[model samples]
Target: MRILLTGGGTGGHTIPIVAVVQELRRQRKDLKLFWLGDDHPEERAAKENNIPFQKIACGKFRRYFSFWNLIDFFKIPAGIFQSFFLILGFKPHVVFSKGGYVSLPVIIAAWLLRKKIIVHESDAVPGLANRIAARLASKVLLGFNAHSAETLSAKSLRGKYIFTGNPVRREILKGDPVKAREFFHLSKEKPAILVMGGSQGARFINDLISRSLSKLSEYQIIHSTGVNNVSVIARSDCRERQSNLISTENHYRFCSYLDVAKMALAYVACDLVISRAGANTLAEIAARGLPSILIPLPSAASDHQFANAKIFEKRGASIVVEQKDLTSRKLVSLITSLLKNPNQLETMSKKAKNTITKGKYFLIKKLRISIFKIN
Candidate 1:
């Protein structure tokens, strides 16, 4: 079987497709895979999976007025032309699209080429790209619940939309706590905290951690400060100890990025997760039954991250704090209060694992064999 995976512009779009590609490779040895995406960020991730990749122009459609949007209007047709030829040459049997600004043209080109298309929407609400792609897709997968996916389209298209949660890297499930203790040199006396802020524009969370790290000395902290903001860690007395990963000031550590293995260990080692409400990361955390404090990106497209976080909050899986209300003092207080109640944490974990939509891979496998498969 030949499969062309399409999505980009952020790790949220790219990572889920990578997880699906990993499952595809594991299920079949004869499959041919190609990735068509935008931007340089995920090219390394694609190559790491040994899949050939092609970059295409992406024209974002904004809800508000922008002069750049007028200029970007032309890139859509150009991208379609590029994607058309690529899809023709690849002649993929199925097109797997994780929706983002980069994917709309790819979806149109694949539809024109008459390829079977399956799309997954990771946000609680569908953005313009997925809202458009859902109409063209033969099967629409939802990272949230059925009601969430149902609202993405009209009642007529409901048959195509299926709730499959979100795809998580299989390696994320295989963490060893003993290895994590030895490697990170974590103290057993203090509770561990994992802080994440997605791949881009993490300065807000970075600053919060900087202000609050000293106040939360009772806990060990590991902060993933996005690649561009790692320098935020080397302040005051702490200097650069290593390359990507740095150990600083008693019980604190920081890293620019976390590959699958490192992320797995971080999940198990930490008693609590503090993160932005990206659906991909939330899926991984939910899979492990980790309770979290989610600070959603208020400015995200359609304000979908906040919407995603609210679902977790409503389910008793996480505490949602608005960006405007977030501060060092409130953060420290929340962390202290939550960590003090072990029973509440356990209840949160149970709700996280039990309440959210899950087991996406099984349905994904069924799609590959049934609706998506072509001889």
Candidate 2:
């Protein structure tokens, strides 16, 4: 069987698609998988996984009118034409799209070619691209129930809508805590906090962490400062003041990025995670049963990050700290409190695990059955 998957522009959209592709490959070794994405980190991720990739030039339709929108409109036709030829050659039995601006043209082209199309919307409020794709797709998958199916029109509700928890990397499904700690040279004696700001990193989070580096030393730190922000963080004067608190040698480790395997290790090695509440990030955290403090990006499309964070918070799996209220002092205090009280951490962790375990595998399996029609 052949499948073409498309999504990009951010790790949020790209990583989940990768997770699904990995699951499909494991289930059917004979599956021919092709990725259609723009030239972005998603493409790099696909390459790292050894998936065959074809680039399609595509652009988003901005909410506001501009000259660039005109340019984008022109690109859409070109992208569709290019996708048409690619789909003809590949002849995929199905096209799975993790909704993103880059996936728009490929989805449209796939529909026109009569390929069975499936779309997964990661947020409660579907992005513009997914809203458009929903009309043409045979199935529309949702990450959460709160999203209005009516927004996609009545046709989506009759036979297509399915609630699949966001797909997460396979490695995160299990991890060896002792091995993970040893790999990162973390002392099992101290609580570990994993800090990640997504692929590109969050400037606001980085700044707050930098200022509170000294306070963070009370706990072991595994900070993925993002590749672009590494130098800025490494060179910041905060290190000079905080060097004594955290071992200049091992108290804190800063990484530019994490592959699927490393990311799994980090998830297992840490006692707590502080991160932006992107759908994929939250899904992985939930799958691992880790307690986290989520700071949703205020600017996320349609304020979806806040909505996503609330879902976890409501389940008692995580604590949501709004970006506007986030400060170095507040973050430091929250981490310190969580670390000092093992009972609270344990309770939160168990809740997260229980909530996620209830449906994690079922969701993935359901999506697989829907896309491949596997019995």
Give the distance in Å from residue 170's predicted Cα in candidate 2 to where it truly belongs.
1.3
Off by over 4 Å in 1: 235-243, 357-375
Number of clashes recorded per candidate: 0, 0
**Model 1 reaches what TM-score against the true structure?**
0.93
**After TM-score superposition, what is the CA distance of residue 274 in candidate 2 from its true location, in Å?**
0.3
What tens-digit string does per-residue lDDT give for candidate 1 at 1-375?
Answer: 898888888889988888888777777888898888886666877888888999898798887899989988899999999999999999988898988888989999999988889988888988788888898888888888764575675876778876667777788888777788666789877889999898663778888998898899889998887766543555432234322567778888887777778888899899999999998888888888999999999889888899999999999999999989999999999999999999999999988886553453554565445434433
Ten-residue segment with the worst summed lDDT in candidate 2?
A: 238-247
Which pairs of residues clash in candidate 1, taking residues 3 or more apart in a chain or in different chains? none
What is the overall TM-score of model 2 with all chains considered together? 0.91
Among the numbered candidates, top lDDT falls to 1
Candidate closest to the true structure, highest TM-score = 1
Q: Listing every candidate in turn, what is its Cα RMSD in Å to the true structure after a full C-alpha superposition? A: 2.4, 3.6
Local accuracy of candidate 2 as per-residue lDDT tens digits, 151-208: 5657445678887767777778777999999978899898888988877778788778
